[model samples]
Target: MERFNKSRVILMPCRDYDEEEIYRQLQVGIRLLGGLEGLIEKREKILLKPNLVRKAEVDRAVITHPAVMGALARILREEGYENIICGDSCGIGTASRTMAGTGMERQMEKYGIPVTDFSHPVKVDYPQGHQAKQFVIAQDALDADAIINVCKMKTHALERVTGAVKNMYGCVCGLQKAKGHTLYPNAESFARMLIDLNQLLKPRLYLMDGIVAMEGNGPTSGDPVKMGVMLLSADPIALDAVFCRLVDLDPQMVPTNVHGMQYGLGTWKTEEIEVFTPDGEVSMEEAVSRWGNPGYRVDREKYGKNIWNALKALKIFQKKPYIVEEKCRRCGICVESCPVEGKAVTFKNGRENIPVYNYRKCIRCFCCQEMCPHKAIEVK
Candidate 1:
């Protein structure tokens, strides 16, 4: 825990997803973090975990850019690390399909990195966990000596911002991820569980692709807005804190950032983080001044246990997901993705009819919103 007393984060400006450019910038960022030699062994089994939420093109900014992943793989291979794999559990479909859809499968083939659906869930007990004492982790993750989290920067309906910390939720195999919402329905509890998972897995490094980030309603369904930045760090919390700063969001308002500090995952306190660029060490304020997007469309309101959340009967007062009848494709993915008992969303009218949400059963987990392929569901 004391190792997190002071954390270093490297922030670099990236205009686009040009493979060569990303490779060069990543090389500098890794070097700034004292290189991977001292941290990861050359022969150690490594897992390059990317945020493959679901099937979508790279331009959508829904998942981590394949170019970033390929560049990281190329760098590792250059470092004499031949044993490497890339994997993630997609939110709504097979990992293979999502990988192919996002052009990640092609990138992996180019780098000779095997892709896993993160199959074979293994029960791992973590008594030290403050929120979750045990977890069912993917076998690939459990076997890896080190994990390099390659996550995307996007707004999330549940967590506000899904960056380095929340990215690890994909470590939970397939349907278990949906079930997790049932276990930890709210942002605070869910974030505590995420902190526990990070503490348990202890990924070697965290990298965020922020050149183009999703905004409005995101994590999966949202519009892409160019932010022109990339972030890297050993501490997920500090890395995410820098992400918060770039979007003009208060890091303290993010549940993961708050619980991460309390549970010793890493520090979000501005004083405890050392943010820098290739020029020299710079203040968080300076980092924002250079690449910050004060106009970025993210929920900046403080999410406390207030009347808004407490008054469930007043559904109109809360931020709940509603279907845009015109956009609804009647795919029933929302119905299938709902983790609540008896299903919060169902085809109440008929199989051919649009699914309806029983708000009474809805946990406001936003699984329906997150998994909706069409831009039908939006929380307002």
Candidate 2:
């Protein structure tokens, strides 16, 4: 395995404002990487894996924009690459539901592309040995001739920023994703796991859908900012570094970048990276300036100290669930999901059956947040 430097990042300015025009720009970006000819052999089965985190409208900036996928599929087809498919596993639901709700199925149908559920998984080993012994990956992803990972640029609750590298986690399948979180509970460990996964299942090409990126608290709820730029790279780590720089975020602060550099995944320093723009030539500073900072506050000292204290005061770390009385429908889902021996969450006798959270034994895993159908649970 060879290490990738910053020189590998290719940033292409999308002059086209409309969807069709944007697709043309995407074709130019891929052309710089030897086009889809060599990358995708004629008639080879190709999987266009996009980040469908949840079933949200494209305008909401939660999942990968269907237009982007539509554009990519069209380009690939033009190059004589047939047998195209699109799929991903959403966090809170099944792939089929996510595809239907997000209108990805319609997009695929428009392009005559097939949609497959990446739910059935098979175990694969990581001989390099970064974190876990092996990972369970969706069989469809593994069987594809090549995977074109189209990831949305967004900030994540656990990983800070989720880009090309983080997007590959979709290959792990659906419910199995929760199990990975359970295995690597902490942020740093989880990042290491992602690095290992990326190495094991390396995609043939990587593209960052930065036209509209999510900032602040994201991968779910966040403000959508128009970045007006797209990036392509053979190296996932380098592409992520470029994305962090464009947003004025420190790549070192991103756990995946840090661990990836340490393990020979990609470069962390900006000076060593050589950036190529669309119009033949442009200064790195000029291209980066076009992407204005999203103004995200990262309190390093406070966050670091708090995490350390929380781990140290494990037993005393109270997980309080503040129920919104107005929103509570007297449902007992919280009580049912509580794993504590003494039943930390219990329904009150006569008061709207309001469930009480006992902080003493709660693990703070936020399972209550996932199980609540009415969005009534808030952990603090």
**Which ten residues in a row are the worst by lDDT in model 2?**
294-303
Full-model lDDT for every candidate:
0.89, 0.73
Clash count per candidate: 0, 3
Error of 1 at 346 (Å): 1.0
TM-scores for all candidates? Answer: 0.96, 0.83
What are the clashing pairs of model 1? Answer: none
Q: What is the lDDT of candidate 1?
A: 0.89
Task: Please provide, for model 2 over 92-148, each residue's C-alpha lDDT reduced to its tens digit, 9 standing for 90 to 100.
Answer: 576667768556677788888887778778988877759877898999888887888
| lDDT by residue (tens digit), candidate 1, 183-239 | 998888999999999989999999999999999989888899999888999999999
Task: Give the candidate number with the greatest TM-score.
Answer: 1
